[model samples]
Target: MFAENKLTEDFGDIRNFLLSEREKTLSEAEWRFRMRGYGYNLKRVDTGYEVARMTTQQVIGTLDL
Candidate 1:
């Protein structure tokens, strides 16, 4: 995330770099909300993303039978 091509020492101190990352990086909630537009309701756990598609009413109704 701190690669030279992305953020070099010329940018300034580490604190400023981290602040910039915070501004640029999306939170987990933001990611989930964005993914939903493409038909995915995912979540981040531990170190990876997982879809909780079963929670949708369509899925639940389909599985009810």
Candidate 2:
């Protein structure tokens, strides 16, 4: 199933489910912050998924952590 909500830009309440369930679920705000801060985010590729650097568009592979 496709989730249309994920496409929205609203960074929902930080003190709600996101903050409380970070260990189980990664919120949009947290991922965006970490991705931009580290210059990378998980990207979907033809083969699968990868950790790509935004500025250079380089696929740096996946990370388990």
Candidate 3:
């Protein structure tokens, strides 16, 4: 397991990087806008990227159900 302090430090580093790359990074709203073109509703998953919702049926089908 990762230590809490280490995790905090890592998150701070990532935040700094994002701040430095703000102009290049896609905001949550922008990502959702792009995903809407593909008929997907995307939301920010974490401090990093966006994610789209998936159904249980899709997961099961993908698993060869």
Candidate 4:
């Protein structure tokens, strides 16, 4: 659920934000399970959660984009 034409730089910042907040925002197990659903296995180190990239496509063909 991101806006169109949002720069890759902006996305990178968002990922950084999530990674920085994982522990403060979610329990370790909760964060791990959530990330694992998207195929990211997180390890608890000095950082909260490592960011993983997933390429998702918009289904605009049926929405008349």
Best by TM-score: 2
Error of 4 at 46 (Å): 2.5
Candidate no. 2 TM-score = 0.38
Q: Which ten residues in a row have the lowest lDDT in candidate 3?
A: 56-65
Clashing pairs in 2: none
After superposition, candidate 3 runs with Cα above 4 Å error: 1-25, 44-65
Reference-based lDDT, each prediction = 0.39, 0.44, 0.35, 0.44
Q: For candidate 1, lDDT tens digit of each residue in 6-49?
A: 63333243334333443654785664564455344444456454
Tens digits of per-residue lDDT for model 4 on 1-65?
23222444354554553455454555768765765554344544453434444444221111010
TM-score of each: 0.34, 0.38, 0.28, 0.37
Query: Which runs of model 2 end up more than 4 angstroms from their true locations?
Result: 1-29, 45-48, 63-65
The C-alpha RMSD of each candidate to the native structure, in angstroms, is 14.8, 12.2, 13.2, 11.7
Model 1 misplaced regions, further than 4 Å: 1-25, 52-65
Local distance difference test, candidate 4: 0.44
What is the total number of backbone clashes in candidate 3? 0
* Residue 60, candidate 4: alpha-carbon lDDT: 17
Cα lDDT tens digits, model 3, 1-65, are 01222333243443343334444547746644644443334344344443232332121111110
Better of 1 and 4 by TM-score: 4
Minimum summed lDDT over a 10-residue window in model 4 is located at: 56-65
Better of 3 and 4 by TM-score: 4
